[model samples]
Target: MLLHTFLAPLALASVAGPAQQDHYGWIHLFDGKTLEGWTEKGGPYDGDADWSVENGVILGREAEGARGGLLYTEQLFGDFEFECDVKINAPFDSGIFVRMLPQKRGAQFTLDDRPGGELFGIYSNGYLFHQSGGDAAWRSGEWCHTRVRCVGHPMHLMGWIDGKLVVDYQVPEGMDEAFTPEGRIGIQVHGGMNDPEDAAVRFKNLRARRLPPMAGENFTVDESGMMTLTAVGEASGWQPLFNGVNLDGWVPNGGSGPMTAEAFEAAGYRARNGVIEALHSGTAGEIRTARTNYRNFQLRMDFQLTKLANSGVYLRSVDDGTNPSFNGTEVQILDDFNWEAASGSKLAPYQFTGGLYGAVAPSKSALRPIGEWNTYLITCVGSRMNCALNGTLLWDVDTATLEPKGGPPFAERAKAGFIGMQRHGSAAESESEVGASFRNLFIRELPEMGPSAR
Candidate 1:
């Protein structure tokens, strides 16, 4: 069974005044006067529901003898914060759906504002959570401010009615495989014989803001605009690889394998105060994971570099003393702004930060400043490799189809091997120091499935 909590309302103000205006980074789903950016479609019923904009509010009613349907946003959202004011007539049934597609079952925040209805309850296949005493939280035939926040692959959902916390639910582990990570937001007018012709639900001041992947209760944005996870949520399936104090599961490349924190430090890396610092000692080497056979996984980490630094993260690399950049794959990491000036040579398109080194370049540059921390979210499954840097997707491509400029095709590279981080030797005297610092290293192994499976 899933767990949920109904907490006392916070002393937050009602959704009025400044709340009606658009904020930075927020997308207004409704234009207040027109039905633009939205589409009416049958959600679970056979015919469309009557939908229109009336006096800056979206009104939903049953169409003639037809059943009710959904009004969905044109754009899709994966993780987001959504807000709107809702007014429902008595005995009407409606809901706000997230990750919803037309005619498909989805997670819903119930607004069944009638006797025996479960207001603010979560309904998917059935009531995932049933909120009792719903009438205490509902204001019949009047506008009630509602907000929903959802995040993660198997989403954690929360809802508030009139500034009071009504539901906080995490999708159960067993249901992880069934959840859709992204879909359109929908407003449903449920079909039922009891729904009178005058019964309707109205929504106004609709807006939403997209959130980063895996962002939830444990995620935060620092003052410098860097996203950090204080701890991985249990439902997120992410395991911390770096314990913030040791290298117990890591090894120096070309050595006898995994070592203790002290032993690993002696091999040119320092682990202290939650950061793993690679000490560049004029000779290029790497630190690799002791477990050498990760075939499909999602790897996330935060890295900071000294000025003009050059480094790379190796995926599925062989242990035959061959260059991992050629044997497997490397996601290039460099001081993008200063690398060319310091090296006195131009960089290939595939040699910049977030690129699949030697094969495919990033779609755009998303690196933070050299001294500030930047994040990498790398997903590898079958022939596809996708990378996101600092919350921006850089590339999502199939390695099998890529032809490298000089080396063998990426399709021939090892499919299972060690995960490593490269230290690209020393920098010139005229250049700034060259080293990389890393933290929050986490990985979650994904089920072995091809791109079509996704």
Candidate 2:
């Protein structure tokens, strides 16, 4: 069972106006009376469409025989939050496009006939993500509200329908370089054959707010502009935490036998070439740095999960515990899609990859597809922590706000402890048998912040 909840309308946070003013410095994108600061493109006959402002709404009703294209914002933006209300009749297709380039390179937040709030990455030929399915939030008689947040640096994108948080996505590595971080915002009139005069889409209440840029190489700032944590870079005096060829400075735990390198290796934890890999051995385990106990530090590593595989990186923990996750902290690493579909399995939002297991949920899903390597940068200082998956800020949160499941209270978590990785087993509950691998493990210790810093 996947705990994916959509909030009720009354329970949703404010989407616009002074209620949102202090939280987000919003700027109106649509003046309502005219399509100023916007340009039209693409249609049956090259940028030709029956697009006009009518009754305070931007309407795109195709002319006879005209296929639709886009009405785009002239100004370009990078990291920002956007909101709008849309009304579309049945048998029509439209979308909200961001970072749009000339050849359809960018991302789209869908307004299709299917689930109305899904994200798709567009390229010259097709889309990058093919996921689809969700509740039909649209009605024949009423307008639908949608909200989107696309943040750069650690590029994370999110979407909400009727104020219900739905799509939380992370742009893949290398994929970011394909389109400009700053590009036009577009209202798409999907190109296809349809009854030109009858097919219509209207948009209103368009507004957006810009987010602060990612400031430091070692640290990250949240959307509201708060310093979360830091990842020490090469120039910042960071050192290798894993030496690649051997477990020279580490200890393995969670097994029932001798805790030696050989025992761990036999238990499926192995060092091959320059990578630390956990082959499938049907046993759950972990490995921790032997002599290092870190408080405020940045830990970076590259991880690859086999199809449906599961594992994790532990922070500030002891090796003697049976459940180190509850004892310390575990940044979950697992195949979210497969893990959720496993038989007899139940997963909460806080149990997915990049999540602070059983505590805080990741604001977005940022993992690469299983079988591909993804980079992770985790920084913990005082009560603040941040995780960046593949150069995207997955989430930034203050630990004091998290509610724990079955451990020492979240507020009372350890100040300093060893860094480690969990070696998951094929438990009877899930009966999963996928493998996990890691490499390029590095860490940089920072001076613990005092009371004033907290």
lDDT of 2 by residue, 50-75 (tens): 68989999998666565677887766
Off by over 4 Å in 2: 1-179, 182-234, 254-261, 282-284, 427-434, 450-454
What is the lDDT, from 0 to 100, of the residue 34 in candidate 2?
82
**How many pairs collide in each candidate, listed in order?**
0, 1
- Candidate 1's TM-score: 0.53
C-alpha lDDT of residue 161 in model 1: 89
Write model 1 residue lDDT over 58-86, tens digit each, in one string. Answer: 99988777468888877677777788999
Worst 10 residues of 1 by lDDT: 1-10
Candidate lDDT scores, in order, read: 0.74, 0.66
Indicate the worst ten consecutive residues by lDDT in candidate 2: 5-14
- Candidate 1 stretches greater than 4 Å from native: 1-23, 42-46, 102-104, 221-358, 361-386, 389-454
